[model samples]
Target: MSNINVDEVEEQMEEDEFEEELHETIRFLLVEFRGSLYTFTKHIANMNCERVHRPLNRRPITSRGYNYIHKILKEDPTNFREIYRMYPDVFLKLNNILREKTHLQDTRYICIEEMLAVFLLVVGHNTRYCLIRKTFERSRYNTSQNFNKVLKALNSIAADMMVKPGSAVPEKIRESTRFYPYFKDCIGAIDGTHIPATVFGRDTNSYRNRHGKISQNVLAACNFDLEFIYVLSGWEGSAHDSNVLTDALSRNNGLKVTQGYFFNATSLFNFFLFFRIIYSIHYCGVRYHLQDFTGQGRHPEDAKELFNLRHTSLRNVTERLFGIFKSRFKLFKTAPPFKYTTQTEIVLACAGLHNFLRKECRSDEFPVETEIEVPPSSSEQVYKDDNFGELFDTQEQQRTNTNAWRDAIANQMWSDYDHIVNKS
Candidate 1:
């Protein structure tokens, strides 16, 4: 009876042990299944959230923009001037000069020609960067980067392109009897023009001119050949021409006036001394503009009018230069939304290009006989400052001599003009 009771107890213990081992196996399998399911679900979510980077400019070789540029250069070379504001040869020559002289280099994808084209499109037509990107079939980053690279390259060769005046008299002045002896000492004409500008914040007021437009008062000196010799830009529109001139003369790389030589200016700059600048007379009720003397019986009646007529003729060159410059580069008419410093650099670069074009192709699109009438002056008050007077007081004797010399020339010019009219 005792042996049978012990056997029953052993059998019950074995059954309990087997049931606990089965439970442990089932729990391990359940945890392993949950972990595998969680990992699979996380991977699916990640696949759904992944981003693919598609290229904006694909197959650039077959792009329409790239084809168009090459087509214009090869098949339609004549139209190149209309598109780039320069003949193909001129453009190529300029490109060569820039490549040889500047730090600009051809990248793996973009050649120097394409880079210059991008810059010219922006400066020539004021085309926006987005449009340029589409035209050139380049990414935004490439278009902007190349435009700036070309700009810096052009500026690097500015000195060579924008040549200064030599001591010899210009052929235009030397050939004309009306200007020869009178303006023999004159090297160039100096004037101030307003270029459209874009500014922000409190600086807008400072850039607002008397004409109620935001602009930059750019002072430029141009030879009679319609080429810029010196350009001083970046002054606020509210600044007077004399003030801009003062700053230009004070700068280290500013306009340099050779001794005994003068620049022809308008009546606005009459008070300037220590510089041999011959300005028009500001007498009240006198005819000073060129249009006033452009009729059948509108010849000058006095010495002052005679001097003014000739001065207006000589000074009109600067106005014509500005006209041609703005017409060539529409960027001057409307300012692009670039930094102010960049805008100033653009002005200088454009001037350099103008000079280059003049040298390369003298008979370009600009009409030689186009009559550009000088705009009438809005104010007759000659720019004067007590500070300027005090600074230049020591040169009073020189100023007096200049005034006397001007009177003598006017008298001589009137005498010659009167004699001619009477003889006719």
Candidate 2:
């Protein structure tokens, strides 16, 4: 009985040892499996982090924007004007001027030409920045920044480009038989035009014109050459032409008229105060507008008619200038959503650009055609006579003398015109 009991105890002890060894193996396998799983998770985490921090590859190595510009400038040069609104040489010259004269500098990635192209596309075509970004292959931030920089650069040169008129008579007047001696004292033409504007709040009412259009009234003076001599912008469309002219005269750096010389204008400026300074024919119940004499057999009937015709022809220069200006820069055709101050600056900048283009490329083609008809009651007239100093005692006397002088000139013109017509 003792031997059997001892065998049983030994068997139990062997079973206990086998169970302990199996438990140890299970724990070891579990630890090894957990370590392998942890390593796999770490690898995946590393790959995900790399992907999250990767730089975007949007623009290609050889960008389409750069390629398009290169192609146009090199292979397709003529299209440059269509795209940029100026010839290659003119554009390059302007770019150089901006670079040398202003604060605009080329970035490592973008050049001055690209910057200028962006600006021209915006102002010339009134193109949106999104399209410009795509065309230039630049980010929105870069495109907008460059545009503003170019604008500032252009403004810096405005003073040099938009110069005051010289005292000498223009060649158009000096050479023309109809105008030479008659308009010898005339320096240029003055007129008021409306430019579309965006206004808000109480300002909207002030900007609405007689045509029921929201616009800004711009008073401009131009020589017969279709170049802007003075430009006064930002007045509300509801403002009178005479009031605008008054404001221009009031400003310290406003339109400067030479003594004894005058600017031809419309009857809108026929005020008692301006009679001595400006000359307007008596147009009440008369045929004075240019459109009246357009068709066949529309010759002047008398001295007043003849004088009206001559005055309208000479003053038409200002209208023609406005036509060319609005045609060349389409930005003026529509109101861009910008600050009023910025809009005013744009007008001044465009005026400077017009003068620059006229001086640089005399034959630049204007794409749009414009014909301006002289409205009824819009008789061309003339303004500040410093040359007639001490000639009259009072304003009334000055006005009387001005009217008499105008009549004498009209009679002389009529005599010469009648003789020529009879001879012909």
Candidate 3:
């Protein structure tokens, strides 16, 4: 028999040790606090009822809470503290809004504040449900049995009460004043993003596609306020953003731009007269904006180029929404814990929350605008010729008209956006 490979044995041993440590760490419980829906109810009940309750003992806290808490908080102590302090106030405000909605029952159910607490805790800590059970020890929600129940309750409320369809343009969001005039014909900015999810499949074709990738393609739209207006989740990761957009547009009648525009990236192809697509083109490696009906790049230095820039600058509403949404929920930073079904629900819920916040706070006027570094100019980069000519034919009548309208609308909006940006 050959001599045993000591190096291989040591590597295997190390791997086993690492796995064991991970298992232990995941299961270990740190300082148990009393923060649960049951405890929450008890606190309310105690406030109203003339009953004496037994006081619970305080114990040394675990590193898990601090570790998870650190993950969500910003690096700068001052900034982190400021946001942390606002959590309670924001919770109360969101709760009051939910109460006003009439969707929640009046029978001493979970309040909106508690629901906000759950969201903040989940987004901030990215911790498990059971660990959250430990934080509110003094409250009525301490029972182990009610952990899932509370989560379900919060989910239901978020779905039914917090979210609203943004089909119609609100007066506040509607363009007004030349500095930032309402884009009357444009409905929303559309985009596709990747959110990680785990799925089981023996037949690779079931989930895998031409791209040979594994992830979910989430198509979401945001209004002018940088609020997520609509979400189309559950498309396979291999699906192109254009295909996802096509499916979403077909599925929802409201999404089909009958009178207004739906701005998207340049990858999306041309559509009919009713639906206008304003996208950007990458010329010489540098992304130049355009509103092309034929989906073809016409002139680099023409008025059309300026129109594309305006279109992109405005259409980028969805991009900012994506950044902020994922930054808040680190679960999106990596793959989601749940499968596709639950993942879709969570994504939609997050979009709703994103819009809810945008509606609640219209202006995020920060003082330190210059603190953020500006990206270096790429105007002089080497240009590559993307074959937009293959996508369209100039002889097509509808395509010609569509391009004309797109150009006109873009020119109008560009002047308006430029004024707004300049004033700011």
Candidate 4:
């Protein structure tokens, strides 16, 4: 027994010596390459290996994890709704997608659900990473890392989720007496709005809008059902809607409206340049119809006025879409403190989430509150209407052609309205 005890003590002392040597080696390497990142990274890797082998004395990750998250989700669902901006089933679906995409290899103690929560909380509320870290009892680095991980996962799903609904104007939109046949060829509405952005260098000037806020001009297209079909974000705030629209249609991977189908956006229509598009407002003063159709938002007096009125009413859904988008994802109203590149990614990621939540919804009532108004065209200043012909276009021939087309549509709408009113 004494011999066995002595041998055990000797073996223990040797193990201690080996551990001390390992520590000394690490310390020496760190000092020798105090500025070398590669060596420092290797040192951290070795330490992490030790940690994996060592019995964990640290408390379980609770904040971004099961300890607190699971409790909140199960015990107080309303609180869960406030933080996640979504219900449990939606959260669970996104969680499953993250797990499936990441193959459950995220071993950083942050579960898939927690990662998604961090992402939504960050973008939806524009909360800082430190607050999230405290909420989840995680380090700031872990909070940010998982936020990005989940963000990328959501972006990956955007291509699949943000898609055309096979039929742009469904039976419901087509059957409405106010819109039928008049807008049968119309699939959706399109428009641009500004989101605050932070960028430095020469880019600062380009992104600065007349409102004096640095922003990114984002163009979005949504169908009548209030679902986003396409979104093109990340243009400089100074970029005209026409320029942005031109670029979007020019890109091979950009928005594609079928040959006959169209989306209503406010831009100059060039018969040669735009074979598939028609401007919602006139290339000239024809916007009066669209404006009255918006400002007072009353029924217009003439057939032409009535046509614009109905068009504006239906097209306003895109504006409402933006309102809901900004309200639900507050990060969009303010510049999120991420790199400009990541900021752009966040924009697209949030849109993807919007579509995801919309698809997952089981009820008809929209959960997000949005008090919407007509935003200025790329031409409006300080939310006030302003003519942008000097900045846009004023071609006589295009104007004539547009007026002719609208006149035909107006006559048709008038005939339909007369028949409905007279019959009644």
Q: Number of the top candidate by lDDT? A: 1
TM-score of each: 0.80, 0.78, 0.55, 0.75
Order of candidates by TM-score, top first? 1, 2, 4, 3
Which residue ranges in model 3 land beyond 4 Å of their true spot? 1-86, 97-116, 137-184, 203-213, 252-265, 269-300, 362-396, 407-424
146-186, model 1: which lDDT tens digit per residue? 98999898888886777788899989889999987888988
lDDT tens string, model 3, 1-29?
23468878888999999999987776653
Error of 2 at 291 (Å): 2.1
Give the clashing residue pairs of candidate 2, or none: 260-387, 265-381, 277-383, 278-382
lDDT of 1 at 25: 94
lDDT winner, 3 or 4: 4
- The better candidate by TM-score, 1 or 4, is 1
Compared with the true structure, what per-residue lDDT tens digits does model 2 show for residues 1-424? 9999999999999999999999999999999999989987886677531122223655432244555665667755568887777888888888888999998997655778888888888888888888888776677778888878887888778867865778787898899888878888888888889999988887799899877789999999888888888889999987778778888877888877766888887677665344335644444566877788989999899887888888889888877788888887888889976788888888888888889889888798585466543343333233344643443345666677667877887899899999998999
Please tell me which model should have the higher lDDT, number 1 or number 2.
1
Alpha carbon lDDT of residue 141, candidate 1?
A: 79
Give residue 101's error in model 2 in angstroms: 1.9
Which residue segments of model 1 deviate by more than 4 Å? 1-68, 275-285, 367-386
The C-alpha lDDT values of all candidates are 0.80, 0.78, 0.51, 0.71
